[model samples]
Target: MTSLPEDPSSPIGESARDTAVRRLQEAFSEGHISHEELDGRLHWALTAKTHGELVAALAALPAEKAGTTSTIAAAGGQIRRRGAWQVPRTLKVASAFGRVRLDLSRAVIEHPVIDIELQLGTGRAHITVPRDAIVDLEGLHTGWKDLRYKTRRSSRPGGPTIRISGMVGFGRLKVRHARR
Candidate 1:
């Protein structure tokens, strides 16, 4: 068992703490821990004093395995990934003067989290996920672009997490909620 710091007030740098939180989120998204378990550990991690304390929060989770990726090119009219098709752990979407849409409300997903890379130029991308799923748009670059989503819904734990990246220029990217 990892021991707590001798001094609780000792500063645990924000970067280190952020890394720990990311690790915890990864574990949660990989189905290694339940939402309740993640919530409990997240509280502990947030109040931790040392790196060891943060590491302990993820020590009990299962190890992750390799995942597959899928790429969708939208140079044509439109690209859609809806219905009963399988969903990859990572998705790459590239659109140039076209439209790309991914509806995950009814898609088959094996993983608890998905990583997406988008490249849009004079094009548009639309994504719809289940209401419970969390959408992380932190890595997206919206310079000279338009990004929109449903702000009325609140994301809850236990559902899949979608971490999005990439950039858009003279294009639009939007996210929405869907029920299936």
Candidate 2:
């Protein structure tokens, strides 16, 4: 095993601390830890001066699941997911003549990359992702209208990536980054 540097101010120590913090965030998003516990552990992880202290901040967390998939389908009604909802690793959405809205600005996203597959028969589908999120719409096919998405520079490096795929027949797909 590679030994981490003792001084937290060192580059190696900072990198180790960052990794620990990401793990803690993932644990919280996976429901392995409460918000309070995550906050406490994050404090320790950021302030730790030694490798042992950093390890202690990540103690007892359950192993991350390999991957989880969730499906949402609607025949004639709207499908919406917003506000602090837990985002799985893979999501499948199917709708027919119904609007689909996914607001992920305030969502709890654990995985570094999330895949969303959409199969819409008709109607418009809108998605609002986090400001730092990177979106890929290359795999999406629209029949009637063009996909509405404006590309911009990501504010933060190593942020979550949202990969959207599948087909939309006679419907429009609009994707935008969150303002707040």
Global lDDT of each candidate: 0.78, 0.86
Residue 61 CA error for candidate 1 (Å)? 8.7
TM-score for each predicted model, relative to the true structure: 0.65, 0.64
By TM-score, how accurate is candidate 2?
0.64
Error of 2 at 72 (Å): 0.2
lDDT of 2 by residue, 84-180 (tens): 9999998999999999999999999988778899999878899999999989888988898899999866578766889999999998999999999
Evaluated against the true structure, the overall lDDT of model 1 is 0.78
For residue 56, model 1's alpha carbon misses the true position, in angstroms, by: 15
Where is model 1 more than 4 Å wrong at Cα? Answer: 1-28, 31-67
Model 2 segments beyond 4 Å from truth?
1-67
Could you say which candidate leads in lDDT? Answer: 2
RMSD to the hidden true structure, all candidates? 6.6, 11.6
**Candidate 1 — number of clashing residue pairs?**
0
